[model samples]
Target: MIRLFKVKEKQREIAENANGRAPVKKQSAGELRLHKDISELNLPKTTTIAFPNGKDDLMNFEVTIRPDEGYYRGGMFVFTFQVSPVYPHEAPKVKCKTKVYHPNIDLEGSVCLNILREDWKPVLNINTIVYGLHHLFTEPNYEDPLNHEAAAVLRDNPKMFESNVRRAMSGGYVGQTHFTRCTC
Candidate 1:
């Protein structure tokens, strides 16, 4: 196949109209895979994807997940994804954009999903990763917690964990840490 603008440094050039008519850069093997993965994405009812940097830049975007069922019900969680020019072979960089009390997500918005790291494979797509993130909210793992205090409370006193989550979501403090407003 013929190659076009250099994938590594190519920036989408805008046309006269603000309608965003920039040509799609000829993707790399990795980017081609990423495009396919995104095009075939099957997000859940409670999940929505958005491109903060505009549709021209599909390499980076955000996914919002609101689990309809489980302890996380009613709360909104956001995840950011940054795909590399060499994608698919490498999982998109994902981070928690919402501040929530979860064992898998730290206060700094870093996520602890296996599929996003060591367990990632080229076969996985945006759908797979989104589902994996949804699962984390539905069933937070006590075994591997990014928030140790939250984990301990959940393990020792289930009721307390629930209470803390409620408090945090209400734009309150769980302890010394102050959580921003949440829809969950």
Candidate 2:
């Protein structure tokens, strides 16, 4: 039975080459799901997604968010998303591309978003994650944080925390960590 299947595949490949066209690669289940999610995306005006690896590679992409309000207002933040081949079943790996002073995002780009971790469900799509990230900027939660120091500052001294965020976003030093300017 396996031999018969292999013979049929070989015949199909030959026929594809005879047409002077490359054999089409079948999309993985994860890739198919990601394609559907992207096609149905309804991103907000403050958000934009880019395929830095080009249109051919959808698995790796960048999402830039510019919050219109809150402590992160006027600041542009970039996050990189790496969708796995088993997506929907597995949460996409998200990292902060822009180093910013935020409780939820650490210096190493590791994000502390719940959906990307413990709370992730198959029903959630890329749009849900994007909105969650945007919500982080608008309302950073100090209760759960990746950057402990930032979280402490936010929880203890809201004023100082806001000041540090501004300084960091302007390409300045926030407690010895030099952040790139992300304001537009």
Best by TM-score: 2
Residue-level lDDT of model 2, residues 15-74, one tens digit each, is 889988887888999999999999999999999999998998999999999999999999
Query: What are the clashing pairs of model 1?
Result: 74-184, 75-183, 75-184, 76-184
For every model shown, what is its TM-score relative to the native structure? 0.85, 0.92
Please give the distance, in angstroms, between residue 68's alpha carbon in candidate 2 and its true position after superposition. Answer: 0.9
Candidate 2: minimum summed lDDT over ten consecutive residues — where? Answer: 16-25
Q: What TM value does model 1 have? A: 0.85
RMSD for all candidates, in order, please. Answer: 6.5, 2.7
